[model samples]
Target: MSNPLRLVLFDVDGTLVDSQGSIVSAMTASFSALSLDAPSRDAILSIVGLSLPQAMQNLAPQQSVANQTRLVDEYKQAYHAQRLAQGAASSPLYPGARDVLEELHAQPETLLGVATGKSQRGLDALVEAHGLERFFITRQVADHHPSKPHPSMIQAALSETGVAEQHAVMIGDTRFDMDMAAAAGIASIGVSWGYHDVSALNSATAVIEDFAQLSPALAQLWDK
Candidate 1:
Protein backbone atom coordinates (compact mmCIF):
# COMPACT_ATOMS: atom_id res chain seq x y z
CA MET A 1 0.00 0.00 0.00
CA SER A 2 1.10 3.56 -0.63
CA ASN A 3 2.10 5.88 2.16
CA PRO A 4 0.07 8.93 3.02
CA LEU A 5 1.12 12.20 1.41
CA ARG A 6 3.38 14.48 3.44
CA LEU A 7 4.06 18.17 3.04
CA VAL A 8 7.39 19.78 3.87
CA LEU A 9 7.45 23.55 3.83
CA PHE A 10 10.70 25.49 3.93
CA ASP A 11 11.72 28.99 4.84
CA VAL A 12 13.95 30.65 2.26
CA ASP A 13 16.50 33.18 3.45
CA GLY A 14 18.59 31.71 6.21
CA THR A 15 17.12 28.22 5.89
CA LEU A 16 17.74 27.33 2.25
CA VAL A 17 19.90 30.16 1.00
CA ASP A 18 22.54 32.31 2.65
CA SER A 19 21.28 35.78 1.80
CA GLN A 20 22.59 37.64 4.82
CA GLY A 21 25.06 39.68 2.80
CA SER A 22 22.42 40.85 0.41
CA ILE A 23 19.88 41.46 3.18
CA VAL A 24 22.29 43.52 5.25
CA SER A 25 23.60 45.44 2.28
CA ALA A 26 20.10 46.29 1.11
CA MET A 27 19.03 47.29 4.59
CA THR A 28 22.03 49.57 4.91
CA ALA A 29 21.30 51.13 1.56
CA SER A 30 17.70 51.69 2.51
CA PHE A 31 18.62 53.44 5.74
CA SER A 32 21.34 55.43 4.03
CA ALA A 33 18.87 56.63 1.41
CA LEU A 34 16.70 58.00 4.18
CA SER A 35 19.67 59.48 6.02
CA LEU A 36 18.91 57.18 8.93
CA ASP A 37 21.31 54.92 10.73
CA ALA A 38 20.75 51.29 9.92
CA PRO A 39 20.24 48.80 12.68
CA SER A 40 23.09 46.53 13.65
CA ARG A 41 23.54 43.29 11.74
CA ASP A 42 22.30 41.33 14.72
CA ALA A 43 19.18 43.45 14.92
CA ILE A 44 18.49 43.01 11.22
CA LEU A 45 19.10 39.27 11.25
CA SER A 46 16.88 38.87 14.28
CA ILE A 47 13.87 39.69 12.13
CA VAL A 48 14.87 37.53 9.16
CA GLY A 49 11.73 35.41 9.05
CA LEU A 50 9.21 38.22 9.43
CA SER A 51 7.66 40.12 6.53
CA LEU A 52 9.51 43.20 5.31
CA PRO A 53 7.00 45.60 6.82
CA GLN A 54 7.16 43.86 10.14
CA ALA A 55 10.91 43.75 9.86
CA MET A 56 10.99 47.45 9.29
CA GLN A 57 8.76 47.96 12.28
CA ASN A 58 11.07 45.94 14.45
CA LEU A 59 14.17 47.65 13.15
CA ALA A 60 12.79 51.14 13.18
CA PRO A 61 10.11 51.35 15.83
CA GLN A 62 10.97 54.95 16.49
CA GLN A 63 10.19 55.95 12.93
CA SER A 64 6.76 57.11 11.92
CA VAL A 65 4.59 54.73 9.90
CA ALA A 66 5.24 56.86 6.81
CA ASN A 67 9.00 56.55 7.25
CA GLN A 68 8.74 52.84 7.86
CA THR A 69 6.82 52.48 4.59
CA ARG A 70 9.51 54.43 2.83
CA LEU A 71 12.16 52.20 4.31
CA VAL A 72 10.33 49.12 3.02
CA ASP A 73 10.16 50.56 -0.50
CA GLU A 74 13.79 51.60 -0.41
CA TYR A 75 14.86 48.21 0.89
CA LYS A 76 12.93 46.44 -1.87
CA GLN A 77 14.50 48.63 -4.50
CA ALA A 78 17.98 48.10 -3.09
CA TYR A 79 17.49 44.35 -2.76
CA HIS A 80 16.15 44.07 -6.31
CA ALA A 81 19.03 46.09 -7.67
CA GLN A 82 21.53 43.87 -5.88
CA ARG A 83 19.79 40.75 -7.15
CA LEU A 84 19.97 42.03 -10.71
CA ALA A 85 23.64 42.74 -10.29
CA GLN A 86 24.53 39.49 -8.54
CA GLY A 87 22.07 37.07 -10.20
CA ALA A 88 22.22 33.66 -8.51
CA ALA A 89 25.14 34.78 -6.42
CA SER A 90 22.93 37.23 -4.59
CA SER A 91 21.38 34.47 -2.55
CA PRO A 92 23.35 31.28 -3.08
CA LEU A 93 21.92 28.12 -1.60
CA TYR A 94 23.56 26.81 1.53
CA PRO A 95 25.88 23.83 1.18
CA GLY A 96 23.92 20.63 0.44
CA ALA A 97 20.64 22.49 0.14
CA ARG A 98 20.01 21.55 -3.47
CA ASP A 99 20.99 17.94 -2.90
CA VAL A 100 18.64 17.59 0.05
CA LEU A 101 15.87 19.31 -1.87
CA GLU A 102 16.38 16.93 -4.76
CA GLU A 103 16.31 13.95 -2.44
CA LEU A 104 13.05 15.12 -0.92
CA HIS A 105 11.60 15.82 -4.36
CA ALA A 106 12.36 12.26 -5.42
CA GLN A 107 10.08 10.88 -2.74
CA PRO A 108 6.68 10.06 -4.14
CA GLU A 109 4.92 10.53 -0.83
CA THR A 110 6.46 13.95 -0.18
CA LEU A 111 5.25 17.26 -1.56
CA LEU A 112 7.56 20.26 -1.17
CA GLY A 113 6.44 23.80 -0.50
CA VAL A 114 7.74 27.20 0.64
CA ALA A 115 6.35 29.43 3.36
CA THR A 116 8.60 32.44 3.41
CA GLY A 117 8.59 36.10 4.35
CA LYS A 118 9.88 36.98 0.90
CA SER A 119 7.69 38.63 -1.70
CA GLN A 120 6.47 36.60 -4.67
CA ARG A 121 8.78 38.39 -7.06
CA GLY A 122 11.74 37.77 -4.78
CA LEU A 123 10.89 34.10 -4.38
CA ASP A 124 10.42 33.70 -8.14
CA ALA A 125 13.81 35.23 -8.77
CA LEU A 126 15.52 32.84 -6.39
CA VAL A 127 13.69 29.79 -7.79
CA GLU A 128 14.41 30.76 -11.37
CA ALA A 129 18.03 31.66 -10.78
CA HIS A 130 18.64 28.36 -9.03
CA GLY A 131 16.56 26.28 -11.47
CA LEU A 132 14.35 25.27 -8.57
CA GLU A 133 11.03 26.16 -10.17
CA ARG A 134 10.06 22.54 -10.59
CA PHE A 135 10.61 21.49 -6.99
CA PHE A 136 7.93 23.40 -5.15
CA ILE A 137 4.26 22.39 -5.26
CA THR A 138 3.02 25.46 -3.44
CA ARG A 139 4.79 28.80 -2.91
CA GLN A 140 3.41 30.89 -0.07
CA VAL A 141 4.95 34.34 0.33
CA ALA A 142 4.59 37.37 2.56
CA ASP A 143 2.75 39.25 -0.18
CA HIS A 144 -0.35 37.18 0.47
CA HIS A 145 -0.17 36.50 4.17
CA PRO A 146 0.84 37.70 7.60
CA SER A 147 4.52 37.34 8.48
CA LYS A 148 6.35 34.53 10.17
CA PRO A 149 5.11 33.26 13.57
CA HIS A 150 1.65 33.49 12.02
CA PRO A 151 0.04 30.33 10.63
CA SER A 152 -1.34 31.97 7.50
CA MET A 153 1.40 30.89 5.13
CA ILE A 154 1.58 27.30 6.32
CA GLN A 155 -2.19 27.04 6.44
CA ALA A 156 -2.34 28.23 2.85
CA ALA A 157 0.24 25.66 1.83
CA LEU A 158 -1.70 22.89 3.62
CA SER A 159 -4.94 24.00 1.97
CA GLU A 160 -3.33 23.98 -1.45
CA THR A 161 -1.67 20.56 -1.04
CA GLY A 162 -4.52 18.85 0.84
CA VAL A 163 -2.14 17.83 3.59
CA ALA A 164 -3.29 17.37 7.18
CA GLU A 165 -1.57 19.22 10.01
CA GLN A 166 -0.16 16.01 11.43
CA HIS A 167 1.23 15.00 8.04
CA ALA A 168 3.02 18.28 7.44
CA VAL A 169 6.31 19.66 8.69
CA MET A 170 8.00 23.04 8.55
CA ILE A 171 11.77 23.43 8.26
CA GLY A 172 13.34 26.75 9.02
CA ASP A 173 16.11 28.49 10.95
CA THR A 174 14.08 30.66 13.26
CA ARG A 175 11.69 30.69 16.20
CA PHE A 176 9.19 32.35 13.90
CA ASP A 177 9.06 29.20 11.79
CA MET A 178 8.72 26.97 14.83
CA ASP A 179 5.99 29.13 16.28
CA MET A 180 4.15 29.22 12.98
CA ALA A 181 4.22 25.46 12.67
CA ALA A 182 2.93 25.15 16.23
CA ALA A 183 0.13 27.60 15.50
CA ALA A 184 -0.73 25.53 12.42
CA GLY A 185 -0.58 22.34 14.48
CA ILE A 186 2.25 20.90 12.36
CA ALA A 187 5.68 19.72 13.36
CA SER A 188 8.77 21.88 12.82
CA ILE A 189 12.45 21.20 12.29
CA GLY A 190 14.92 23.97 12.94
CA VAL A 191 18.28 24.24 11.22
CA SER A 192 21.22 25.25 13.39
CA TRP A 193 22.95 27.35 10.74
CA GLY A 194 20.22 29.89 10.17
CA TYR A 195 20.08 33.48 11.42
CA HIS A 196 18.43 32.61 14.70
CA ASP A 197 20.45 31.06 17.48
CA VAL A 198 19.88 27.33 17.99
CA SER A 199 18.80 28.02 21.57
CA ALA A 200 15.86 30.06 20.28
CA LEU A 201 14.36 27.05 18.51
CA ASN A 202 13.07 25.49 21.70
CA SER A 203 9.71 24.78 20.14
CA ALA A 204 11.15 22.72 17.28
CA THR A 205 10.26 19.05 17.12
CA ALA A 206 13.84 18.40 16.07
CA VAL A 207 16.83 20.58 15.41
CA ILE A 208 19.39 19.51 12.84
CA GLU A 209 22.91 20.80 12.44
CA ASP A 210 23.32 19.88 8.80
CA PHE A 211 21.36 19.02 5.71
CA ALA A 212 22.60 15.44 5.79
CA GLN A 213 20.65 14.96 9.01
CA LEU A 214 17.39 16.12 7.44
CA SER A 215 16.19 12.82 5.99
CA PRO A 216 16.72 11.05 9.26
CA ALA A 217 14.97 13.83 11.11
CA LEU A 218 12.02 13.65 8.76
CA ALA A 219 11.88 9.90 9.10
CA GLN A 220 11.83 10.23 12.87
CA LEU A 221 9.19 12.93 12.73
CA TRP A 222 6.85 10.83 10.62
CA ASP A 223 7.57 7.71 12.66
CA LYS A 224 6.09 9.43 15.72
Candidate 2:
Protein backbone atom coordinates (compact mmCIF):
# COMPACT_ATOMS: atom_id res chain seq x y z
CA MET A 1 0.00 0.00 0.00
CA SER A 2 1.13 3.56 -0.67
CA ASN A 3 2.41 5.44 2.31
CA PRO A 4 0.07 7.96 3.95
CA LEU A 5 1.02 11.56 3.41
CA ARG A 6 2.12 13.60 6.44
CA LEU A 7 1.48 17.30 6.11
CA VAL A 8 2.67 20.18 8.31
CA LEU A 9 0.82 23.41 7.89
CA PHE A 10 2.27 26.65 9.23
CA ASP A 11 0.79 30.02 10.12
CA VAL A 12 2.56 33.06 8.73
CA ASP A 13 2.50 36.10 10.97
CA GLY A 14 3.52 35.14 14.46
CA THR A 15 4.78 31.62 13.75
CA LEU A 16 7.15 32.27 10.86
CA VAL A 17 7.81 36.00 10.93
CA ASP A 18 8.03 38.49 13.78
CA SER A 19 5.91 41.05 12.00
CA GLN A 20 4.23 42.46 15.09
CA GLY A 21 6.17 45.70 15.15
CA SER A 22 5.36 46.47 11.57
CA ILE A 23 1.79 45.26 12.00
CA VAL A 24 1.16 47.57 14.90
CA SER A 25 2.76 50.48 13.11
CA ALA A 26 0.65 49.95 10.01
CA MET A 27 -2.49 49.59 12.03
CA THR A 28 -1.75 52.79 13.85
CA ALA A 29 -1.22 54.49 10.53
CA SER A 30 -4.46 52.99 9.23
CA PHE A 31 -6.44 54.39 12.12
CA SER A 32 -4.61 57.67 11.93
CA ALA A 33 -5.74 58.05 8.34
CA LEU A 34 -9.30 57.83 9.52
CA SER A 35 -8.64 60.14 12.45
CA LEU A 36 -9.51 57.45 14.94
CA ASP A 37 -7.80 55.99 17.94
CA ALA A 38 -6.23 52.63 17.17
CA PRO A 39 -6.84 49.70 19.43
CA SER A 40 -4.15 49.07 21.99
CA ARG A 41 -1.25 46.78 21.16
CA ASP A 42 -2.67 43.96 23.25
CA ALA A 43 -5.98 44.25 21.50
CA ILE A 44 -4.24 44.13 18.12
CA LEU A 45 -2.17 41.14 19.14
CA SER A 46 -5.26 39.35 20.32
CA ILE A 47 -6.74 39.57 16.84
CA VAL A 48 -3.52 38.82 14.96
CA GLY A 49 -4.63 35.53 13.42
CA LEU A 50 -7.92 36.75 12.01
CA SER A 51 -8.75 38.09 8.58
CA LEU A 52 -8.65 41.88 8.36
CA PRO A 53 -12.44 42.33 8.27
CA GLN A 54 -12.93 39.92 11.14
CA ALA A 55 -10.11 41.56 13.03
CA MET A 56 -11.61 44.98 12.51
CA GLN A 57 -14.89 43.64 13.80
CA ASN A 58 -13.24 42.27 16.90
CA LEU A 59 -11.50 45.57 17.37
CA ALA A 60 -14.71 47.52 16.96
CA PRO A 61 -17.55 45.08 17.30
CA GLN A 62 -20.21 47.75 17.38
CA GLN A 63 -19.04 49.50 14.20
CA SER A 64 -20.92 49.27 10.93
CA VAL A 65 -19.68 47.04 8.12
CA ALA A 66 -18.91 50.09 6.00
CA ASN A 67 -16.78 51.50 8.80
CA GLN A 68 -14.99 48.19 9.24
CA THR A 69 -14.45 47.97 5.48
CA ARG A 70 -12.88 51.40 5.53
CA LEU A 71 -10.56 50.33 8.32
CA VAL A 72 -9.65 47.19 6.41
CA ASP A 73 -8.86 49.08 3.25
CA GLU A 74 -6.79 51.66 5.09
CA TYR A 75 -4.96 48.99 7.02
CA LYS A 76 -4.07 47.10 3.85
CA GLN A 77 -2.67 50.18 2.22
CA ALA A 78 -0.70 51.18 5.29
CA TYR A 79 0.68 47.68 5.69
CA HIS A 80 1.70 47.52 2.04
CA ALA A 81 3.40 50.86 2.22
CA GLN A 82 5.23 49.95 5.41
CA ARG A 83 6.40 46.71 3.83
CA LEU A 84 7.62 48.49 0.76
CA ALA A 85 9.55 51.06 2.75
CA GLN A 86 11.00 48.54 5.14
CA GLY A 87 11.94 46.31 2.21
CA ALA A 88 13.66 43.10 3.31
CA ALA A 89 13.74 44.23 6.91
CA SER A 90 9.94 44.29 7.07
CA SER A 91 9.56 41.05 9.03
CA PRO A 92 12.47 38.90 9.96
CA LEU A 93 11.96 35.20 10.39
CA TYR A 94 11.57 34.04 13.95
CA PRO A 95 14.66 32.37 15.42
CA GLY A 96 15.27 29.05 13.67
CA ALA A 97 12.07 29.34 11.64
CA ARG A 98 13.99 28.84 8.41
CA ASP A 99 15.93 25.96 9.90
CA VAL A 100 12.79 24.10 10.94
CA LEU A 101 11.06 24.68 7.63
CA GLU A 102 14.18 23.68 5.74
CA GLU A 103 14.68 20.58 7.84
CA LEU A 104 11.07 19.48 7.35
CA HIS A 105 11.01 20.30 3.64
CA ALA A 106 14.09 18.13 3.21
CA GLN A 107 12.13 15.11 4.38
CA PRO A 108 10.54 13.56 1.30
CA GLU A 109 7.86 11.80 3.31
CA THR A 110 6.60 15.09 4.71
CA LEU A 111 4.71 17.68 2.71
CA LEU A 112 4.66 21.35 3.74
CA GLY A 113 1.75 23.70 3.37
CA VAL A 114 0.64 27.08 4.75
CA ALA A 115 -2.71 28.27 6.10
CA THR A 116 -2.63 31.94 6.98
CA GLY A 117 -4.89 34.89 7.65
CA LYS A 118 -2.59 36.96 5.42
CA SER A 119 -3.91 37.97 2.03
CA GLN A 120 -2.42 36.13 -0.96
CA ARG A 121 -0.56 39.24 -2.02
CA GLY A 122 0.74 39.75 1.49
CA LEU A 123 1.64 36.08 1.94
CA ASP A 124 3.42 36.06 -1.41
CA ALA A 125 5.48 39.10 -0.50
CA LEU A 126 6.39 37.60 2.86
CA VAL A 127 7.54 34.26 1.42
CA GLU A 128 9.32 35.90 -1.48
CA ALA A 129 11.18 38.35 0.70
CA HIS A 130 12.50 35.45 2.73
CA GLY A 131 12.97 33.06 -0.22
CA LEU A 132 10.60 30.55 1.38
CA GLU A 133 8.48 29.72 -1.65
CA ARG A 134 10.20 26.42 -2.48
CA PHE A 135 9.33 24.94 0.91
CA PHE A 136 5.54 25.13 0.53
CA ILE A 137 3.28 23.24 -1.88
CA THR A 138 -0.23 24.38 -0.94
CA ARG A 139 -0.79 27.84 0.54
CA GLN A 140 -4.23 28.65 1.93
CA VAL A 141 -4.77 32.35 2.48
CA ALA A 142 -7.46 34.76 3.70
CA ASP A 143 -7.82 36.08 0.17
CA HIS A 144 -8.90 32.60 -0.88
CA HIS A 145 -11.02 31.57 2.09
CA PRO A 146 -12.88 32.82 5.13
CA SER A 147 -10.97 33.99 8.19
CA LYS A 148 -9.37 31.39 10.43
CA PRO A 149 -11.32 29.77 13.29
CA HIS A 150 -13.75 29.03 10.46
CA PRO A 151 -11.66 26.04 9.25
CA SER A 152 -12.12 26.80 5.55
CA MET A 153 -8.45 27.47 5.03
CA ILE A 154 -7.34 24.31 6.76
CA GLN A 155 -10.05 22.31 5.06
CA ALA A 156 -9.04 23.61 1.64
CA ALA A 157 -5.39 22.91 2.35
CA LEU A 158 -6.15 19.32 3.35
CA SER A 159 -8.29 18.78 0.28
CA GLU A 160 -5.75 20.35 -2.05
CA THR A 161 -2.88 18.30 -0.68
CA GLY A 162 -4.90 15.09 -0.38
CA VAL A 163 -3.81 14.82 3.22
CA ALA A 164 -6.30 13.47 5.69
CA GLU A 165 -7.18 15.36 8.83
CA GLN A 166 -5.46 12.71 10.94
CA HIS A 167 -2.31 12.97 8.87
CA ALA A 168 -2.04 16.75 9.06
CA VAL A 169 -1.02 19.06 11.90
CA MET A 170 -1.29 22.82 12.19
CA ILE A 171 1.55 24.84 13.68
CA GLY A 172 0.77 28.34 14.89
CA ASP A 173 0.94 30.62 17.93
CA THR A 174 -2.66 31.66 18.42
CA ARG A 175 -5.79 30.08 19.89
CA PHE A 176 -7.54 30.99 16.66
CA ASP A 177 -5.19 28.64 14.84
CA MET A 178 -5.85 25.95 17.41
CA ASP A 179 -9.61 26.43 17.14
CA MET A 180 -9.45 26.28 13.37
CA ALA A 181 -7.44 23.07 13.42
CA ALA A 182 -9.87 21.58 15.92
CA ALA A 183 -12.83 22.62 13.83
CA ALA A 184 -11.24 20.75 10.96
CA GLY A 185 -10.42 17.74 13.16
CA ILE A 186 -6.65 18.10 12.75
CA ALA A 187 -4.11 18.18 15.54
CA SER A 188 -2.15 21.38 16.16
CA ILE A 189 1.09 22.50 17.74
CA GLY A 190 1.80 26.00 19.03
CA VAL A 191 4.92 28.13 19.14
CA SER A 192 5.81 30.43 22.03
CA TRP A 193 7.35 33.42 20.28
CA GLY A 194 4.22 34.64 18.54
CA TYR A 195 2.04 37.60 19.45
CA HIS A 196 -0.76 35.61 21.11
CA ASP A 197 -0.88 34.31 24.63
CA VAL A 198 0.86 30.94 24.43
CA SER A 199 -0.83 29.84 27.61
CA ALA A 200 -4.14 30.06 25.78
CA LEU A 201 -3.08 27.43 23.27
CA ASN A 202 -4.42 24.56 25.31
CA SER A 203 -5.94 22.96 22.26
CA ALA A 204 -2.51 22.29 20.76
CA THR A 205 -1.05 18.82 20.93
CA ALA A 206 2.09 20.46 22.29
CA VAL A 207 3.40 23.97 22.73
CA ILE A 208 6.99 24.27 21.59
CA GLU A 209 9.49 26.87 22.80
CA ASP A 210 11.70 26.75 19.75
CA PHE A 211 12.17 25.24 16.32
CA ALA A 212 14.58 22.63 17.70
CA GLN A 213 11.78 21.34 19.91
CA LEU A 214 9.38 21.12 16.97
CA SER A 215 10.72 17.96 15.35
CA PRO A 216 10.40 15.96 18.52
CA ALA A 217 6.90 17.26 19.17
CA LEU A 218 5.86 16.39 15.64
CA ALA A 219 7.34 12.92 16.02
CA GLN A 220 5.40 12.49 19.21
CA LEU A 221 2.18 13.52 17.50
CA TRP A 222 2.74 11.08 14.64
CA ASP A 223 3.29 8.32 17.15
CA LYS A 224 -0.04 8.98 18.84
Tens digit per residue, CA lDDT, model 1, 81-170: 999999999999999999999999999999999999999999999999999999999999999999889899999999999999999999
Give the local distance difference test score of model 1.
0.97
- Candidate 1 segments exceeding 4 Å error: none
Best by TM-score: 1
List TM-score per model, in order.
0.99, 0.97
User: What lDDT score belongs to each candidate, Candidate 1 first?
Assistant: 0.97, 0.91
Stretches off by above 4 angstroms in model 2 are 1-3
Q: How close is candidate 1 to the true structure, as a TM-score?
A: 0.99
Worst 10 residues of 1 by lDDT: 146-155
Q: Which of the numbered candidates is closest to the native, going by highest lDDT?
A: 1
lDDT of 2 by residue, 1-224 (tens): 66579999999899989999988988888788878889999999899989999999999887788888999999999999988998758889988989999899998879999999999999999889999979999999998788889999888888888989999999999999999999999999999989888788989888999899999999999888
